[model samples]
Target: MKLQPSAVGIVVADMAASLAFYRSLGLAVPDEPAPHVEVPFGALRLLLDTEETVASFDPSFTPPTGEGRVGLALECDSPADVDTAYERLVGEGYRGHLAPFDAVWGQRYASVLDPDGVGVDLFAASS
Candidate 1:
C-alpha cells in the first residue's frame, strides 16, 4: 500500500466566512455557497465542510475544544504581499494571529485564524 498527501480539509462552522477569507488570498473559489466546497490548487485541493455536514455523517463526531492542532502555510508573491494579505484578512474581521514581520528563518510571515480558529499562515521569501 502507498499513501500520498492530497487534499487539506478544514471543518468550518460558517462556510460563507471561510470562503471569503480564502478568496482574499486569490483562490478561485466560486461565489455560490454549499455545505462543502473544494477549491482546486494545482494538483492539490482545499476542502471546506461545515460542522453540521460532518456531524451528519458521523454521529460521534465533535469539534475540537481548543486551537493549534492544524496549521497551513501559504506563499505570497512577495514580502509586501504577505503584509498586504495579512492586513486584508484582519481588516475583513478575521482574527490575526501575528502581524506580518520578517522572521529569522528568512521569510515574511503572518497568521490568521479561519472561522473555525484554524491557523492559516501567510508567508513569502524575505526580500
Candidate 2:
C-alpha cells in the first residue's frame, strides 16, 4: 500500500472572509456561493469548505472548535520577506499567532491565523 498527499482542507465559517484572507497570500480564488472552493498548487489542491457543507453530508459531523487542526507553511524569498508577509497579514486584521523570529533550526518563522482561525505559517531560510 502507498499513500500520496492529495489536498489540504479547511472548514470556514465565512466564505468571503476566508477567500479574502487567502487572496491576500496570492491565491487566485474565485468568488462563489458554493459550499466549497479550491485552488490548485502544482499537483496538490488547497480546499476550503463551509461548516454547513460538511453537516449537510454528515449530519453527525461536528466541526473542530480548537486550534491546531491545520498547519500550512508558506515559503518566502528571504527572511525579510517572511517578516514583511507576516506584518502585512496582521495589518490586514489577521491574528498574528507568533511574531517573526529566527529559529535555531536555521530559518525565519512566524504564524498567523486565517479568518477561520487556521494556522498559516510563513518561513524563509536565514541568509
Candidate 3:
C-alpha cells in the first residue's frame, strides 16, 4: 500500500492559545476544550495534540526546540492582506517572527509564532 499525506500534527502546550491563533487567521476551529483537536487545513488536516496526550502513548516523547519544528504557510488574498494579518496578530499579543515585506519570490510575506513557538507564515501575491 502507498502512504498518503493527510495531516500535520503539532503538540501544543496551550490548546486555547493555539486554537485562537488559527481562528484569528480565518480557520474554522470549534471553541471546545480537548486534549486533541483536528482542524481542516485546506486539503489537509491539521492535528493538534497536547503534550500530555503524546506522553501518555510514548513515555519518551519530548517537545522539540528551536529550529526544525513544523512551519506552515498561509496564503492571503492580496499583498495588503498579508500586512493586515501580520499586524492584527502582533497587535493581539502574538509573537511576530518576521514583519511583512516584499520577498524576492514575488510574494509579500510575513511570519508569526504560535504559543508553542511554531512558525506560521503568511503570504500573498505581490501586485
Alpha carbon lDDT of each predicted model? 0.88, 0.89, 0.92
Off by over 4 Å in 1: none
Task: Compose the digit string of candidate 3's lDDT tens values, residues 1-127.
Answer: 9998999999988898889988998898989858999999999999999989999999999877673488999999999999999999999999999999999989999999988889999999999
Per the 3 Å backbone cut-off, how many clashing residue pairs does candidate 3 have? Answer: 0
Per-residue CA lDDT of candidate 2, range 23-107, in tens?
A: 8998778866468998875578999899999899989989888778889888899999999999999999999999999999999
> In terms of TM-score, which candidate is strongest?
3
Tens digits of per-residue lDDT for model 1, 8-125: 8888878998898788778899897799999986678999888899999999999765678789888899999999999888998999999999999999999998877889899999
Index of the highest-lDDT prediction: 3
Error of 3 at 77 (Å): 0.5
Ranking by TM-score: 3, 2, 1
Error in Å for residue 105 of model 1:
0.8
1 against 3, candidate with superior lDDT: 3
Clashing pairs in model 2? none
Candidate 3's TM-score reads 0.95
TM-score of each: 0.91, 0.94, 0.95
